[model samples]
Target: MKRISVLAAMACLAACDKSGFNYDNIIDDGGSLQYSLLDSLQVQMRTVQLDSIRTSGTGTGLVGSYADPLFGKFTSSSSFRLGLPSETDPGLKAIYDSVELVLQPDGHYYGDTLPLQRFQVYQLSRPLVLPKDYDAFYSHQQFPVNDQPLADVTQRIRPTSGNKVHLRMNQQFGLELFEKIRSKSDDIKNEEYWRDYFKGLTIRGVDNSAAFRLLMNDTAVVMRIHYHIVKETVEEKTIDFHMNLSELQFNSYSYDRSGTPIAGLTPGADGIMGETTGNRTFIQPLTGAVTRIDFPSIAALKELGRYGRIMQAELVIKPDNGTIKNYPVPPRLTLTLADKKNVVTQGDTISNAAGVQYGNLVTDKLYPENNQYSWDLTEYCRAMMAADEYNYRGLLLAAPFSEFHTQLNRLVVGDGGSKQYRAQLKIYYLLYE
Candidate 1:
């Protein structure tokens, strides 16, 4: 009998008006059916520290350092091996002019770029190889480098201007490279020999430097050795070594959260409640920090009535005003299922009838009150309401994995107990006798 009544209620919902209806509106329909809207559900928010995520083969180079008042100091460095040039010989009459490392910006940056930033390039002590038991390099991985730097440069970076960053390399280094190709040594004859002779390089930014994204395509980042042929007109020639295999490149990131609201947060530990962290939660995937949301009062809905169904559920999240001035918010955000231990379940992302929800973001710079990220949580709420046992699973709000590994975008949102703009959950319920 209960199954038949549930099927009948579903049929009625399908036949009802599909356009839209006001909340709590009682449609007579000459039947004993009613609807109610509940928006006072208690929400719990927290900041969880995730384990190191894979950062290799992203095809983007990240280098620099920046200090954040809320997130502490963040630093990134890129490392990769260069391929052998097609034409190893620069001719016997070639006279070494100079060499420079060129980096093309990809128009992505964080923090202030007006100040002079310092960058240094170091030769790797060993070859670029994964660890014994590791399959891929993670954001926290690091490689040993030579003490002496090959190139050191300082300049104001303009990432979006389409200008490339050129750093003059050491003359001794360039001369030795030219000599190897000129003499036609075994080191310059093949890729493996060349890789062994010239292991790799690591580029890093000094402390307090702003982070910027650089193109890591086969031809984008290159080392060019310029030379002049002793011809009648002094003709010039160049040999280029590029970052050939995109999968060989990676970026390493580190962060210090000392003295911050989320201090002492670590992976595998229960997350810190937003109320204890100044009533706010943070989402910065680059550093493995994501926002956790829980519907603590969802089970209480059963007390309202025995035959009640959730017709719709909506979650609205608001960022604290004045939090995104220099640091831009991520364009899209998604939710994934997480266990009570704060471990995110793999391949359990949440989605609605329309597919994966990206939190339709509404930006309002003029009036911050209009800024919010809205998501449809109807299906998830229905499952929670129908569960016989109490559900301890929660959602982890974060950027997509692709963007999370490549970009350092961040967001600070108000929790349910925030004094200012707080997160809200609204559900439309239908009751039948």
Candidate 2:
């Protein structure tokens, strides 16, 4: 039994020797640990301003104005060309009676809705001409309108509650259109000539103190002319003009962020050049604003005595709950890498069928529980360490579907302060010899 005990002790020592540790080292010190935390390392944070994004008209919406006390005021206008009806022949002596314009909602809106909002519809003074390959349109593009409005409407509408806006139009103008179509003039018969004759229509918020959203798709904007024909018995018929693919269309949005928390922000500043004196960062949709992040200290990780493989890396951004109040937060937010010149370029590691970088924002329940956004950037950080490529350029944060949609949501992030709700980057790694 004593010899068996001695052999068992020898075997235990051999096992420890194979494992690169002795009993003393194993009990008192971690001799064969695969990883160790670089205790002296922490990321540095800085803020930069993002440039204005293109507000190209996509999806199905022509949004309008609304005001927010915290985020400031937002206004939008829609311009679209009209197409004539297929059935032009309503028999002889077609007496045009009335005309109406109908607009539908896409069930999305922001800000106060209790106050009455006014909208005006005007005819464009010139035709909306565009090249066949025009990819995008900015909010700054201008199309002058006639002095007289075709229609005006004022009402309290809750688009979120499945309501729409209806406006009575000018009957005299409707009658003129009917006459021109009946006569089959070149201006009325040819599509290009029709657009030249009618130009386009613009729907804008006139004297609105509140803001709302509407889905202005092919079927959203409709002009119907009710007329009666003296054929045997007075038969009533309606001719409709639709804003569809027959012509070019676009949406324009403007923001008056004055007298708000971010009022002093320079309009077009990009990156650290646009940093404000305050210790807070702001983000707004509708090409309003974006948050830029930079990490100079991340490059220093290599200076540590060891090299490591990044097992997990996360960027956690905490939002100021008080700033958002009861406003609806954006459903998703995006993180984009910057170029070598520190410019946030348009290339994503992932691209869609059209080759356009598919910018996917992290959309999940991480925001509501802790009022924060936690992004899993492990692969990104790993690539950064491996190639040392864009680790210095940091990232850009913006909302999804905001390039073309009129979303009024905004977020406030704590920065460079003693506040508990600040943005941070956390990483867990395994060290190597």
Candidate 3:
């Protein structure tokens, strides 16, 4: 937020205006704010901080927020009505505002040059369960359709009753779904050319139930649907794992591939990394609002079982917008020094510098075809936060959050000037015993 003295400094800096207050001939967009010699004087400006953070809980964690300011000034009896709905919590507040002097010569049309008030408002709701009162919430509700502008190819899902275990997969991701069926035998084992299978491919009825079943071919081969999303919402659902295969072992892991656009894994590293090795992992979150936001959030996931033995799983969904309110995050985010040297001169270039370094800092997407993002090394980016003064270990995961976006803030500004500046935010979580 700009302080009072800063506002004065701004006015003085622009005092270089000739016709009126040209202050270096201000022109951010295509046009400029100028003055003529025959107009009176006036100024309007404001600065504000959101009052308090709003919070809600789910399982054992919470999420919260920041502030947004509102201000304006006009010559007449101004009457501007605001339309912000305060459905929940204390009404919003106007942090600061003021109107003042522009005394100057006549014929010199003049006006104020104050940075407008702007902030992101948020409401953290109680963290919800996967199948809790789901029916009551979305029973009659219909999701507003914004059809996929581009449809992805459907993976050819083959199901052979015996031979291997198969799992169904989401079509948006174009990876081949492999079913590990009965390994090998004497008779027709030589025909293992992409183990052929049968699948009931109809787009109606108890979709998954009719499809995600175990089947075997005469040659003793099996197929499985890796995973499936049957119900849009459920009051009670379970993920039945083949207790025999699972070792009943659940591991904590973080998304560390070079392609994800998370907060802490850019050209450096942060807390989310699992020991620079593959074993350490972080649990993916699934919350109600977030479930409704992302395609594969926890609430939207359902793992079918053998004899209906549901595997235990928990999910927390977060808002798609990049902020760490209810989620445990540092009061403020301070990024590690970006390499700056590996800057890209073009987008499609696949040179050594183009692979990982440039992807995280310059683009939200890395593996665009698969909708994969880039990650920022949270600890390195926020090395300053680890000091004794900050003390953010278990309380905060200390990783960066990412979102898929098309407009690259880099291209819009280039070397000419910076246009819109945004940061890779933090994603926090705690996997309990």
Candidate 4:
């Protein structure tokens, strides 16, 4: 009896639908007025092409969920091929220099109806010195002791039997070395001679007198300065894959010191390196569109010098009024560094092996609520360090199914004609001596 009643009810409903509504009319309207699938319902949509974008800050912004602070979280698929004379063959180097993603609109535009709504830039100020090792910074600066044995009075010039001489910066600059040195002084620029002499000797000094020094292998120092291309600003022949969106527009944004409008920069395959060590936190002051507060993770804070805590982030956006008709937001993409340990030690030659460990990262403002990272970062860092392989995977950072660099590739999807959003991507940098 229940089954018969249920069948009768279904029939009645079906009959009522046919009698009261016309499915044909709805289709004619080009909208699902009466009924349709999700895809068919959005007909008034304006399309921004899949080919229009490439890049986000997180290596995973291409597929992850993030509201990019900078429009950098998004960029057009513009191709750039730079000319580098230093490279002999330029195979990998050539490829690195020839990749970029161009952003395209459904229609070409000009003048009052510019296809792109917002174009901005950001400038970050960083300190010149780097902090790579522990005990690197001090209240009073000091130099390293020379690692090589001193000149050999006996075959090998070993400094004074057991006493190894530590060369400080002041020692070479002192009156003793500068006043008495007689070699190569005739008709030579005295300043040039002095500078060369200091470079040759591992002179040591202690602080005003404060010029400190540490004696290290010149070969090691030279090795540290090597410049291998890390990230190339690029536009590739093809993209990995892409998604389609009806429309996108920019609303309000956190404006910091986005540098001069990004227009000043030529988009090309320029291998840029990470400006600082990976994931250090600092407070960045803002002017125009850049906004915020910052407190970087302990590991990142330590890795980046104090200046890094206050850093600049660029959000490249083409802002539009709330309801612009067809402006498109470029898709955010990312290139993640394969994480490993102890592989990269030089500015040049960024190997996939040298990417920083995922476990070592800690961002204070990764989430939108603007929550703070642990204040006692040393303790928090220690706790993170204590995790074993078994428990650490998901607890510290999110776990991945197959790929290791989920952080780099994650990006936010736009919806409800949302105006403000972001996708982030990273570039590595090097300081060559």
> Scored by CA lDDT, what does every candidate get?
0.81, 0.61, 0.18, 0.20
lDDT of 2 by residue, 291-314 (tens): 666555555444221333455667
Q: Write the per-residue lDDT of candidate 3 for residues 292-388, one digit (tens) a residue.
A: 0011111111111110111121111111222222322212211112211211122111223322222222223453222112333323213222223
Cα displacement (angstroms), candidate 4, residue 61, comes to: 14
lDDT of 4: 0.20
Off by over 4 Å in 4: 1-75, 78-355, 359-433
| Tens digits of per-residue lDDT for model 1, 1-433 | 1222333444545555444444357465765566656677788998989899798888899999988888888899999989988878777788999989999999998878889999999999998987899878998889999999999988888999999999889999999999999999898888888878888999999974589999998879999999999867989889999887678789999888898777778886577889998889999988989999988777656443334567778888988876878778777788776677766654322574323457857988798866889887887776666455434567888997678899888999998888677898877767553
How many clashes (backbone N, Cα, C below 3 Å) per candidate? 0, 3, 76, 89
Q: Number of clashes in model 3?
A: 76
Cα TM-score of candidate 3: 0.16
lDDT of 4 by residue, 329-405 (tens): 21221111211221112211111233212222222335532211111122222322344433221111111222221
Worst 10 residues of 2 by lDDT: 1-10
Alpha-carbon RMSD of each model: 6.1, 8.8, 31.5, 27.2
**Arranged by lDDT, best first:** 1, 2, 4, 3
Comparing 3 with 4 on lDDT, the higher-scoring candidate is 4
lDDT of 1 at 379: 73
Where does model 2 exceed 4 Å of error? 1-31, 34-52, 131-134, 229-235, 267-278, 305-307, 340-342, 346-369, 382-391, 401-406, 416-418, 431-433
Compare the candidates by lDDT and give the number of the best one.
1
**Residue 330 of model 2, lDDT score:** 64
